[model samples]
Target: MTDWLSASAMLLAGVIVGAMFLYGMRRRQDRSDLERADLEAKRDALIARLREAPDPSLERDAAEVLRKLDKMGVEAAPLGGAAGGLKPAATQIKGFLWGAGSVAAIAAIVFFVTRQTKPAAPADPLADLERSVQQNPDNLPLRDDLAKAYLDRNNIEGVSEQTQYVLQRNPSDARALTYSAIVHIIARQPEAAAAMLQRATQSDPNLVDAWVGVAWLNAQAGDMPRAEAAMAEAKRRHPEMAERLDQLMAHLRGPSKAEAVHVTLNYGGQARGMIFIIARAAGVTSGPPAAVKRLPLSTFPIDVDLSAADSMMGQPLPQKMRIEARIDSDGDPLTHDPKDPGAVAEGVVLGNSVSLTLK
Candidate 1:
């Protein structure tokens, strides 16, 4: 989400800066045009006088003056259409446009490259998993990546697909069970994740991740005391797991840490409308992404740090995954509805996947 926002902000800034630069250049050219016009008028008057004069000496002086004026006129002609013709005017306009476009392109490229090279946002469990999947899509370890991304994003569409896939193989996979519980919890299903975590813990107490997941769920329900106890117990039983447990505690205390995802959504071809970004758990009913966040839009597409507890099943996210980036209209600034304000723009896709390295 931070990645999407940051990219959007950079794009907007580039456009504004480019526009300003072009406007300034045009103003300068306009001023030059006016000055050239005045000079041409003076040159023309001198030429006319030289042509009408009769006295030999006076004619000679006028001719000399006319020559000087003609030379000055030639030099200034390019600035206006005086004598340089339409070709010069067209060339000047073309050069102005090309120069402006080149500068804008260079600046935009620099900004984009910088954004991509930066580290990921804070550790969003969902983002981490997405990262993992992107890094190792074929590496089976991230088989659960898509599901987790959707779960974290609260995407209601593909939960069943993800859960079904996971359970099909590891019928008793703790991660799958925990996610199912999370689905219930997010759906307001009343301690669904807790119940699953409880069963999983009893069946396999060593599943520290499951314990962490339960603790987070409890914390979300305002059961702070229960959440703390759960985390403490997990830490005590597996001292080596204390680090992971600590992360869970922090996340339950507030929003999950942000994970940076440097992204560029080029809506290839002639597509219309602006893109709307949203981040919801994979299985929830949350609406599309929006600016409901408190931060200014300009601060987006930034790196967000995420804690370990931000993951889907209390496990680290795989890597990079393509979170749903809804391509829609960005309506008028004065209007509120962004979904269908009736405006559209060209769309281009710059590779449909995140570039992640597999372990």
Candidate 2:
């Protein structure tokens, strides 16, 4: 008879090696599955982000996610096949001695590990707001909150997009219309801004922003009385907006002096291109002007006011100024066509008027 001891040794060794190999494969598969699950979760998050607020980099990130998905496709293959060149009795004894114990230990370990729960992470306020907005696109209040959050973060485009969607669904939405008006203001579309603000006020008379916006628009158009009236009515109706309205009142009133610079331009030639009225701090030879005004050269001998309203630096109006008047032949300030007519008057006092001639 063949040595039973030798056969038993080989059988035990084979069982141990096979058990180790199988365990390693299972561990790898588990890790791969976990990775795939994590990737899928991340993919879903990315898709949500893209839907809410997308940028150029998101496409690259999405492509990378797809590439990773192409991998981790290992099938759960069942370990199979009968023992060959080994005595059945020896194999049975080996399995009984080691395989059952090993399996039990692994199972116990796995069970304990899986039972331990990970602590939940803290919620992100912005992300939570975004998710809420995404889930309920019709909810205008939530969208407004989200838009305010975006504005806090200086995300103007995001705010605009949110406002646009809300307005598209409900054109009469007061808050959305106000936000759209603000967007138009940023885009330098004063007419559109005025229209939107008017709609907002008509839609909801209680909206403080609509009234405040009307005030601001009127103030910008040199209609101080109307601006003050609108602001006063808003403050009377919504006392809670007093602090903000007060600040706006200060801005609209401008400097305490409200000094004015009256200019008379004399050009004999027919108007062409444009004219620029620039005022700089007196005695400052080379630098940016404190205030500037540009107007079409449709008519010669133009009369215009240059004041703190047209200030470029927000610089307090100096006691004295070096005022300049330039008529560009090309209508472009960046270029000098040599034929441009210009005049400079040094040491011009505030509230003093000067008549300039193009020679």
Candidate 3:
């Protein structure tokens, strides 16, 4: 409350100063206008009196009036008198605009500097989730969200702790099963991971992660039919996973003989971001990719591979396609940021290796 009052007081003082300065400038201009009018009136009266009486002193007075009026920058008829009498008038200022910038600068400095500079506490992104879990300890969804958040941050211990908590309470929790399966996989216990994933899929058939895990396990076992079935089911259930399924399928199928694509980037010390190696139908630039591969953000001179497994909707690419290598600034493929370094190669063949330079 005290800080607020001090800030308000400073703001009010600045406004009053600005108002006074403007009012003073206006009053000065009004005084100049009034003085010019008074001088012009005296000059006219002197001229009329001199014409009637033929007075020499009044003629001199008329000339003096003209001089004073001229000095004030108001033009009027000159008196017929001596030429070499007074010094030249000083140069007049156009307006008070010259002082405006300085006054505004000072005001801005005060306006910025007067406020308290409180040091902001660094934000914890998962604070809300943590608090929610703390308040509702029995909420499984909150615990799941907190677990995912921890997993994203690579807090492995936190992930283990949360998943254990949930599974201990409800062993058949689908999401918790998926999280445990992932933990098993990371621990190099593939059999245990497979069992957990299978249970997760049985518990929740709509769990995309369980379906993906099943597909990956089968594909690695060379059971292409089961893998393809799992993928087909996932695509039918959740179409948004098509891009990822394609990429996963392509990678599991291994590199093709005639359809392999190798893209080399000649990146010259630019911003590091996720690389999107997208293949579009020939002459097409809009919409999703015919085939795409995403590489991790890394240093310059990165190599990328794109093949049929990366194709959307389990489709094969045409003989020729437009291959675009883009370093997505925000990792979003749909939106393009102009700052993202990119290169395009037209009419690239399926088996060809293309070299691109990012700018």
Give the number of the best model, judged by lDDT: 3
Candidate 2 TM-score, true structure as reference: 0.42
Candidate 2 lDDT over 1-359, as tens digits, reads: 23445444555565675577556656665676577667667666777789999877886786677577655432212111122213434544554556646655555555455445535689888899999988997898899888767755546678799898888888898988887776565433569989998889899998887887777667657798988998898999999889978776775666443477788998886647778787878987545456667677767678887766555212346679998888777755545676678888999888888999976
lDDT of 3 by residue, 1-359 (tens): 76566656655665566556666766776687677668878988998898799988998899998889777756676442223123121111212333444455665666566553665678886998999999999999899999888766646578889999999999999888887776654433558879998889899999887777677666545588988888788888889889887777776576675676788987876575578888887899865457666677777687766665555323466688998988888766656899888999999887888999988
TM-score of 1: 0.32
Q: Give the Cα error of residue 228 in candidate 1, in Å.
A: 0.9
Off by over 4 Å in 1: 1-142, 149-159, 168-170, 251-359
Worst 10 residues of 3 by lDDT: 84-93
- Writing each residue's lDDT as its tens digit, candidate 1 over 1-359 gives 76566556665665666566566666766776576566567656655675786567656654664455465445533344545545545655565566656665765686678777987767767767667766875544365556666765657445656666667777676666766676655443445566777776876687666677678777655688888988898898899878867876765665432433333333323334443332233333245321111111232232222322333344433233223343333422222343431221122122222321111
Candidate-wise lDDT, in order: 0.53, 0.71, 0.73
Per-structure clash totals for the candidates:
56, 0, 1
> TM-score for all predictions?
0.32, 0.42, 0.42
State the local distance difference test value for candidate 3.
0.73
lDDT of 1 at 23: 69
User: How many backbone collisions does model 3 have?
Assistant: 1
